[model samples]
Target: MMRSPANKIPADGEPELPGVPHVHVASVVSALATLDAEKAGLDALAQAMAGPLGAAFDVAVATIHNSHGRVIVTGMGKSGHVARKIAATLASTGTPAHYVHPAEASHGDLGMITSDDVIVALSWSGETVELRDIVEYSRRFDVPLIAFTSNPESALASSASVVLNLPVAQEACPLGLAPTTSTVMQLALGDALAVALLQSRGFTALDFRQLHPGGKLGASLKFVRDVMRKGDAVPVVASGTNMGGALVEMSAKGLGCVGVVDGAGALVGIVTDGDLRRHMAHDLTTRTVDDIMTPAPRTVRPDQLASEALNILNSRKITALLVVDGTVPVGALHIHDLLLTGLA
Candidate 1:
């Protein structure tokens, strides 16, 4: 039997390597062949289902979407691992899901199943003995059962409300003892189902950010409003304010720049440290901000994404951006803000 690198260990009498372990080329080739077979299997399954069960796939999505309760995923052995992953993907993508070991269900966990829940059962042959109790319970309680298997005529398939009969394919294992291609197909199908449901439900990136708020993805989806310095914290000076006053505002606000607003409170220009450097030789107390400020400086909207703001800051080689509502400046965003949020 072939073992993956993760499961491989030294035999009883085999000597351990000192350093820089060598990979087995033949094992790698075998693993590549298994990956190729699974790719083919997925293509074949997609083509087969497109012709016959396309409408059924839509029905399954609708059923899962309309259900008031969570999706209960169940399976045994390797299929159980795939089931757990499928449940996690579904939960993270807006569909509520949980994994229940069928063996545990037969003992007492069957009580967790509710009539409002939908059942997604995984079995390659559709005849795993441990899954019998959960299937029976789902049947008796009138919960919708979605079966993922290779046999259409199997008992599990016969009892299901919707059956996703995966294309028959060989196991990648040379001895046909381990599940490789079959489990890949199951995982791919689970991902497809979750994505279809996500699109059907009109799930937005904002909604996804709310669900996953701990990672780089969360930072990427954060809005400009979430991090920008707003209101009185923003450096501002009237369009007619002297360079002396603008400099004082820039120093007081500590944004390294000051926004110049017109009589209507519309941003007319921005005076950065660069502007101060260029005009320092001039009579600073006599020079008006309009004489040295950059007119129509690059700006971002309060509703824009921080990532986009980062892009602007990068492409323009600027250190800060004024967040505006039309011509009205509402906030200020320094590169430090994005850096603080891990978005830079």
Candidate 2:
């Protein structure tokens, strides 16, 4: 194929590719049309959910909640892609789920589906030829089958124990043949199902953190104990220590601050670089730590979430928080630690 000159502009105002034909529609115009079609599909889906779909949705949520076994999500072609994502979302949000390919289920993979499991099948037309085997298997084993399709009267819907009849809408494809808006609605409905299940189970962010422990989100969910400086790394001085001694500890620990503890070894205050600047005087080093320390400084517990610690740092405009066990200082958390852990 011959290539057109990079700087050349065609007389029709369209890029002159070697084999592709020119069309009058601008790319942005086509994108807007696709978005409008998908938005219409979602709007239709929302309306259906508020009307006829509500009762069935409640039933579906109840069935899944009652089931002790995992969710087996299966679909064909484009629906299969969406099914995989749905399965992942479900699994990540406290529900156990797996995606089983419709065609693969025919070749001994059907054994993966158990009588106790619920099958979620997706097909826009509800007549995908590849889903027949899985559908038949669900019936033979008496497994509850949930079907997602626009045609409630089709074979798959008729066979399903729960039918999520999606509202019909035009496809985003100009030819009206591709699975654009339809797939978007399917994915949205799948997300809705997963969220409903999550809420029903009272799934929490801490639980979600367990499933996603290798990302920035995981770092944010970490506890203060996991990132705080412990033992000798924490800079501390007795409540009556001279400012010189407190400054020495702060500089030695390099945390920009030093925790001040009373004779009982309980954190009573904190002296920071700002304190030193504010108390600047020829006799500064002669003064006691209590003279310059900020009493009842904002503190955090070791068990508090790192994100919460970050909130304190941001809201109070402070660089460090002393982690305490009751009244005793156990550790110190510096802003740098949060930055290193990707929580800041």
Candidate 3:
């Protein structure tokens, strides 16, 4: 028995047999072909969205947006997996949505959907046997039914109130049996619906933060006031204070900088390590803080997002930002603070 190239592992620096592709090379080719096929499918989807699908998509978005209840997303098999992700995206983006497996819908999950709720079903063929119960339930209750399918003539599409007819395209799978390009199209369409609804509702970043309060995204959306060190934690010196006193305040506060406040308690300048280095001289300690400070140093408003403050810190190449109310220094934020908050 002769070992084929696939069964025979090539040793280091050994050439592959003539007219035979290495396993890795064949895999790369397959991967590239899959990508190309998916890309083609996406192109077709984009074209459909611009053409016949536009009116139906708008109607679907409006139907979901105007609904007083949550969106019930349902599908079978690979489409079920995509439906779950779509539901999550919709929920996170301010639209109430949840997935119900078609198989489970027949087994008593049908009660999970209400008459007020809208049903968004995903089925490439639109004839999934498991989806029949959901379709019937939607029809019986007069619940709004939105269908995603390539076959507009299929049972699901014929019964749906809004049929988003997907463009039939070649599958990424070489055998053309697996749900590859079709699932991608469904997922992309689901995202489009979610985003359209989200925009229609005027959902803000603060709203998003409220929904996602425990992650890095939450930290990034936090207000500067929420992260800044307030009150006595901020290092400060009187406008006319000498560099020696300013240095003491900076060292005591450990923020590497001291804010110089005028008589009215408004921030006028900042004395940083860089300023001290630039003003280095025999009389440096005796110099007035004004002489060693940088006037109108970059500052962030307390109401600004921490992510914006991070941007300023990175662009200015500085480690600290003074949080201000008008010209009054109320707080200080260090790069370390942002890092601790997981914003960096």
Candidate 4:
């Protein structure tokens, strides 16, 4: 064992300083056991879905699709938290959705719901009192109701057009009163619904980018064309151009590299600073660009995501890449460009 030089225990208990207590191995084991139990509960929920519940999921997806308005997600207590997250997930994934608190719905927030919209009500016990008003309103207005709960016979489930009754499982909480395991089931089921709807609607990343355009995620989704230097800014020289001219172009473009193109205007090779360094002994003024260029250099497409370009640059250990459409060089991207845009 390596001890720090600062360590100096008091000799013969002259004074034992107060210190952080060591964690008990038994407590660690118990915590791990709890996780295992929760995972098993989730697993049971998955298994239960293989039967009639699977059909109910399909029906729910179809109901949401056929609706002309947004999905109004309603719930109470911890279930309300899960409902809000589910609503956000659905909205971001192309299915328009919003959370409406059941208690608030009774106090005129119910007006936010329309007959054209579908209601997704969540209640672990399926008999939450706050949900009664909205459930009754949904029934009265002929609004489709889909329920996610643990009790099929409860009011919420009985009133729903589609009831997804989750399998009962023990809570990870020792007191068996906290919402732990039940909330996990609700969240997982909600995620499944969102993904199913996303796939059904053919939701693409581009559609997602439209909804989320203010973070690293949005930056990662930006296309190469959005950041690449195009036209006269791209450092290019004819294939037979002299290395001195190529170096001049590389410097002028300030990307530390120049692209070599053939007579047909097709990119044939690239000349980087490293290429110049390796050919330093040669007469660069007389050597043709092709004589010292790296042929078939790694290239990115104009439509590729910036993150994809970053991956190419990082994996190749290079600073710049030529953006091409097939064999023709259209643009160039330097690592600094990505850094400037917060995409790196």
Model 2: which residue pairs collide? none
Q: Estimate each model's TM-score.
A: 0.87, 0.91, 0.93, 0.90
What are the Cα lDDT values of the candidates? 0.90, 0.93, 0.93, 0.90
The TM-score that candidate 4 achieves is 0.90
For candidate 3, the TM-score is 0.93
- Candidate 1 lDDT, tens digit per residue, 1-344? 99997667645654334443434444555667888888888887789668766777778899999999999999999999999999999999999999999999999999998999999999999999999999989889999999999999999999999998888988878788799889999999899999999998899888898898776778888999999998899999998888888888899999899999999999999999888887787488689999999999999998898999999999988899999999999999999998888877
Candidate 1 stretches with Cα past 4 Å from truth are 1-28, 277-285
Q: If the candidates were sorted by their lDDT against the true structure, best first, what order would they fall in?
A: 3, 2, 4, 1
Q: Compose the digit string of candidate 4's lDDT tens values, residues 1-344.
A: 87664553434524222453232334465676689768977898899889878999999999999889999998899999999999999999999999999888889999999999999999999999999999999999999999999999999999999999899999988888999888988999999999999999999999988998877888898999999999999999998998878878988999999999999999999999899888887577789998999998889999999999999999989999999998899999999999988887
Error of 1 at 134 (Å): 0.5
The worst-scoring run of ten residues by lDDT in candidate 2 lies at 16-25
| Residues 216-303 of candidate 2: C-alpha lDDT, one tens digit per residue | 8899889999999999998999978998888889889998999999889998999988998999999999999999999988999999
Q: How does model 2 score by TM-score? A: 0.91
Winner by lDDT: 3
Write the number of the candidate with greater lDDT, choosing between 1 and 4: 4
TM-score top scorer: 3
Off by over 4 Å in 2: 1-25
